[model samples]
Target: MELVTHSPGDGVYPPTGDYAHAIEVRGAERLVFLAGTMGLDPSGVPGATLDDQLVLIWSNIRVILASAGMTVDNIVRLTSYLRDASYAGANAKARVEALGGRVVPTTAIVAQTLDSEWLIEIEVTAAS
Candidate 1:
């Protein structure tokens, strides 16, 4: 699949982040909308800490994407919700690792609370 990424063309400096302002896919043959995924182990146990869960969540998303014959490079959009605002750094680090430097359109929100067990949840939209 061919994808086009856009940022401001206004000659201004862009923000420091791993995301593109927007992503465009032309005639994408397939699209997948994944539901919000949270971190959990193979035994279906939620991670004890935010950092651990971040890795697990991304891992699960990768598996799901692979199952659909897609990869993180095919992701056009990513939305992440965090239970605590301070986890932003960890979140960004994990996301960068997960995307492997691919720039995708992304939004991240911090909620006052999620379920007691989940530190983060992520939703994805991919095309290939």
Candidate 2:
């Protein structure tokens, strides 16, 4: 796989050391776009807190990535929907850490989620 990184001269640098300006992958044989995943456990129980939900969501994403014979590095984009926008930063930080510093995927965090009981939902797009 070929990856591209862009650093615009006029654009401001990223505050966090984790991500690049952008990532591009070309000549992909297959692409996967996963549905929004909630924080439900194996038995369909929701996590008690936002931190717990974040952890579970990350784990689920990891599992899905592995199923496709890919890793977090293969992800190109992510969309996260949160029950509360105020908690987005903290949740994103937890997700990045869970991925072990690989944060190339572009992310969007929305305040309004589909379910009231859910704290967060994450969708991903990957190629390999």
Candidate 3:
């Protein structure tokens, strides 16, 4: 699979170590779009902080991808809904580390989420 990224002149550069872009995967036979995942752990406990939430979300994404016979590398896009956009840089860095620095899905971070108590929500699109 091929990953695609770009930096448009109108957009701010992603914080250091991250890309302000999206990834595109070509020649895939099937695609999957995951529902937005919240910060709940397997037992339904909420993560204590934004970073914790990010880790849990990425882990959940990995599980979902595996179930579909794909890996994190197959993910083409990630849209994160965050309670506060100020946390984007640190959260993005955490995500890159979680994904092993190889899968750079096109990402968008937005302020505000469906619930006030949720620090972050992540939705992904993948192919296989």
Error of 1 at 28 (Å): 0.3
lDDT of each: 0.86, 0.78, 0.74
> Model 2: per-residue lDDT, tens digit, 41-119?
8887888988888878888888888998987777877777877778778777976786677766456566767667788
Best by TM-score: 1
Q: Sort by TM-score, best first: what order?
A: 1, 2, 3
Over all chains combined, what TM-score does candidate 1 have?
0.91
- For candidate 2, give the lDDT of residue 73: 72
Candidate 3 regions exceeding 4 Å error are: 4-17, 20-22, 103-105
In model 1, the runs with Cα more than 4 Å from the true position are 11-13, 112-114
- Candidate 3 global lDDT: 0.74
Error of 2 at 86 (Å): 1.6
Per-residue CA lDDT of model 3 for 6-124, tens digit only, reads: 55556665544554455556667899999998877999787898877887888888888889998877777778777777977877787677667754544666767756778888888
The true-versus-predicted C-alpha distance at residue 12 of model 2, in Å, is 6.8
Q: TM-score of predicted model 2?
A: 0.84
> What local lDDT does model 3 show for residue 80?
78
Which wins on TM-score, candidate 1 or candidate 2?
A: 1
Measured with C-alpha atoms, the lDDT of residue 106 in candidate 3 is: 49
